[model samples]
Target: MSDAPVRTLLLWCPDWPVLAAEIVDGVPATGPVAVLHANRVVACSERARAEGVRRGLRKREAQGRCPQLTVVDYDPGRDARAFEPVVAAVEELVAGVEVVRPGACALTARGPSRYFGGEEAAAERIVEHVAQACVVESQVGIADGVFAAGLAARTGRIVPPGETPEFLAGLPVEALGRPALADLLRRLGVRSLGDFAALPAGDVLARFGFDGALAHRLAAGRDHRPLAVRQPPADLTVTAEYDEPIDRVDAAAFAARALAEQLHDRLAGHGLACTRLGIEAVTAHGQELHRVWRHDGLLTAAAIADRVRWQLDGWLTGSSRRGGGGPARPTSGIIRLRLVPDGVIAQAGLQAGLWGETGEERERAHRALSRVQGILGPEAVLTAVLGGGRSPADEVRLVPWGDERLPARPGPPPLPVARDTTAAGGGEVADGRAAGRRRGGGSASSGAAGAGRGGAAPPWPGRLPPPAPAVVLPSPLAATVHDADGEPVVVSARLAVSAAPARLTVGTAPPTEIVGWTGPWPVDERWWAPAEARRRARFQVSLADGAALLLAVEAGRWLVEAIYD
Candidate 1:
């Protein structure tokens, strides 16, 4: 909406995670390496990429692509800590350096460009300073706004004044970084920034909401939002010293949760929320480990604890994975751990809803979950989230109860799956709704125990339609499906059914009459991998007793994979 776009400069360090690990662990830069999060590749070195490794590939797949690749779990704190020196170096040249994230930062270009003679010169100076300060590679870009600057930085470009829009017109819509929105645009034939920016602003707002409008502004080479940079307060650090060294992750995490709560309470008293945190630890042998973590928004108590846990997991386990023989285990144990609030912002007070539960109830739930985490470990207490996937299992993502839940990846909507009350082992049958009442007593207990456990995998293209089975067995149960003539039923590779199913026998249960049946829905999984290829046909049948079952035929054998009660 402004007559003149804000002049912004961005500095980005590619593969910062892998580089940070290399810096911290003394790993050579030439070797193929990747940084993983949730067992998926988040970043990889140029060497690794050249070897066919890519972001989002599973760890095994990445390794399969680059057999000698070094894998490291992503540690935001570590990346941030390692980048502080780079930020300090840049600040020496520019007065205000706002870190966009751990690996990137942005600053107003007007002052620096004039001082350094030109925008291109300023960029060169920043890159030189960072490289000399940390021995890491960095790229710089100058454009009309932060969004364009960030994309330009990826290509190390400098857009002349008033040319930002024209410069960005040809780039892919993905430059906006909103995957779902970008995917939608692509499907609508708006594949480039020019295509997107050409649409009516009101129409974009009416259809895509706030996020889409913001992306549209970015594509048009306009600033999406204003920046509010704040200086972190000194002396806002909390530390814990152990009388007896704590060597295990569980113990360290428990201590982290307590400290995190204290830190949050302290910040709340000052009406502040931390946006960036620095975690430091001292091992018994006197080895010091430090890392910084940055968040786009305020960090909650649980989020802080989760970062602490991740940092410890990386430091404690990372040593063993360092090349040239594992670094000697931390001589003794961790003697001290400290958390520093590196960046803070004022947060508006949260008003309780008139009809909704009060803040006290939320706090109580938080405390209960924290206690469980302390007892059973962080992964044991999880919250379920629906994400992009075809099957119920693929759609369900379970993150630690206290941690942030990210948006699901962009993809087609999942087919509706029927909810089975007895799926976990209790629910009504068609003939008698009360049939599961007696079994319902233990259902809650069983469900609680499996709260974070995921459901069926991503929907296989030819998988069964929703109204998914109430219960999916961990392992298929052996069964037999026969035709009315008492002969075994068969489905050919071409998917022709030999005969209609008439009888079903599961495990040691007596054969039951099939009242109805549907499907020979076939799936050919991993057909390209000879060793792992699977060809199967599935059928859903209703038994005379009002029980429903999902049966699969693989290699001429019938197996009961799920039941609907």
Candidate 2:
């Protein structure tokens, strides 16, 4: 919307993956071919295009256009995998290039233009470098802005500054991105860009909104949009296809090493470092071999390759294979190998410590421990902290170190707990303070010993207490028991109010009087169950006999079930 001028470059590759596939693996550059999805067309080869086959056309329609056309599904994953090296190659030529998709990338012309003597030369250098790395032909276009550059790339036409509007005036109105605008133009008898541009801006804005005006701007080639920037060492992956299947361990290792170099180059170009790598090998019959290799620090290309080879060799020697002869082993023939870096962080070199001395030592120790833990089960190592909860069982929770960040427990807050069981008296800390003061000169350990052996005492209000022994019945029961006044009490409904007599019993335990009680807590949970088998209310009560419990009576009998901690 501003009057400021902007510069951009558009790069595109026609049938990029197919072409890259041919160049990299030396496949035949055959006849009319199309990249398809199931039976729909996504992109067409030049031969297919010459025969009038277009993108988004049905496979049958495309075939109708060129009866001899060969169709292949659009494999975006494969395409992206193949294009990694190309992006890396381009990165070597320009500092801030944006990838438009699987194949094309856009780079600002300012830096490259000045360095290479102009936009044209910059584009030429990019194409040349990219072609060499990816082993494929590429096209580049530079213009005033992103829209114009994109348009230029599609047509392989470069437009110099200040000539965009004039150039666009002759294009069809449909080029503006509003199919509806084309219909409108047709209705209004506007056929060309010049005719559309001749209309007043106010009229277009009022009828069509900003999109209509944007179409007008694009048509006029007045591109002023800035390039979107992306920061990296982004995670990088590399995959390679072999001319012949390789089954032998040494040959497979060689292939993996080559792929690693390419991957290493790509990652380095992005200024990224990775700690984990995964290698995948695909067999002739579509069988895939997957291996995950990890390292403590930045992985070198050769090291990654070695790990892949080792894993593949091990698997091939161990697993049984079908067909002629005896035990199966890696053959000398391999078709493809893909290596991917997993543990990616936006940092360079070894990750640093927070401050100075203590931080450095602490971080180093953590890293070492993490490496060891990664090899073992993640659950095998853990840290525990005091959590704010009503019961002792809920007070302390174990958390995985690397994968989890222990959240600050909510509400009444935590009781004091220890970091390690060996610390002081094995007490858990709440916030930064310890729980429960000890009397006299008793050591913290001595106090814990006494507390642990004596079981837990009653907890005060707002404080977490040791777990209580109580049974939760799945359903309510109907039982008669003697009240404090020695009278028969019959149970009905759900939760008993404080005034209700103790009338439920399980096993040989005598019915106890309710010393404390809370809530009917009505539950309609089983509304979806059988109509007659639903509905109940729950109650929490402490008896005069020192038994605290959750009980429910339904369907006539009390069932002793879950012990609420």
Candidate 3:
């Protein structure tokens, strides 16, 4: 690396998410707006901050301070998308610019500054160009390094050469951008960055962890974060803006496909693969829709198009509609649609054949399945999750893709059984059939037989399970079904159903009768709660075909939760 000052200038567009929302809604840029994450305020417009609504304030507290504050959900992708035009404008001003975050970018200003006369002059021209192109209000700061420049931009105060220490001295410790150090400094009654910077580095590190060391460097205005790369990245994504809004999904998909083809060619020419992609759609009335997707391996043009299609489908399907009524849906009539590649890594090894055995095959399959499922709806596909809880049924959770993956709960070892096999009390494999397979099938038979003797059955194959009915309509129904013979049956806590064979299926099918029975297990959850909060269960049943079923009867209902194949 060159031992130069790096000649970088940093530009920060303040409250990017709020501004992006404004742009999307075509809302007038007036009054204060704040973006929220959970209950805390994450970002606020300058107008809102001036009104005494600052980031980190509790929602109720902020509202009390700025009653007129317009609140919106914090969307990082929207902020990033809205910043694209700003990046393009800056790139034209300098030889190169790198986005440091959704709202901030850094570029070498040496050449541009020289051509424009001085650092100050170049910064002014860059800011002016952006103001002319859009309604976004921003700040530009030029200094010897990123740290100094960022502070200068925020404070609009210039620091002379070698004066970075003095400039950073008066700023709050929070400016160091390390949450822990800032908190510690507050506890120690040190409010300013300079206060902590003056402390011995060794002492700071010992008490505050690595953050103390980082604070020391930043307070001194010495930034070690390299410029990343000096050239523009190779994964160029193409987008087209339509003059009129297009509401048809097919049209949008077609246009998106054409763009992806172009982007793929560009990537191929550079021997690169784009792993991340973003799609943006501007609706007729100015509502902006955006999506960010990732591919584990090299993403093909067709895959890109499919992703765009899914995003639109998600929006069109009203997945955003939660409660009965809210705001009307944005007209599908799309005004502008853009596709952008976020980053690219070399594709040199991606073409290596014999995709089997290597990890790449799994990733490819996952990508393909994800695309198909996206079109079909997420609930169409599911992944099994293992867990151990009082409810033998709750021990395993099945979650749809892209949703929060149910975490593995610490408990008994894997039962060595699937949905077809039955899990006895404490989640022990109790059935020998292992669901749909014959007793002599494979390596699993020995284990299944052992488990079955203990009342745990292997998951059965090919038996279609009734669609879990909602006893109360939309809400999940928890009902007990006494078998035809009125024997109390216990069901698995997890409502997992395997076909008589364990193949996954779409839609719901009728539940089959139990050919064999195995368990009368008791499960008690929420023991720490009041007695009324606790639950109990018993399970086991037999089918006509000699297949054993594990059923759980809880709260006086007989539900066929799982089967032993």
Which parts of model 2 have CA positions greater than 4 angstroms off?
17-29, 37-40, 177-180, 232-276, 279-290, 293-340, 343-565
RMSD of each: 12.0, 15.3, 11.5
Candidate 2: 10-residue stretch with minimal lDDT: 431-440
Candidate 3 residue lDDT tens string, 404-489 = 55545644323343333333221222343322222312222223222322323333211212211111122223433334445433
Residue 550's lDDT within candidate 3 is 44
Instruction: Please list the residue runs of candidate 1 whose C-alpha ends up more than 4 Å from where it truly belongs after superposition.
Output: 1-85, 92-94, 98-133, 136-237, 240-262, 269-281, 287-334, 340-412, 416-459
What number of clashing residue pairs does each candidate have, in the order they appear?
9, 26, 70
Candidate 3 global CA lDDT score:
0.62
- lDDT value for model 2: 0.60
Per-candidate TM equals: 0.52, 0.47, 0.58
Off by over 4 Å in 3: 1-7, 24-29, 186-191, 234-265, 273-345, 349-546, 550-557
lDDT string for model 2 (340-369, tens) is 887754436575445633354654665555
Check candidate 1 and list the clashing pairs.
77-292, 81-292, 391-459, 393-455, 393-456, 418-467, 418-468, 422-426, 423-470
User: Which structure among the candidates has the greatest TM-score?
Assistant: 3
Look at candidate 2 and tell me the lDDT of residue 404. Answer: 39
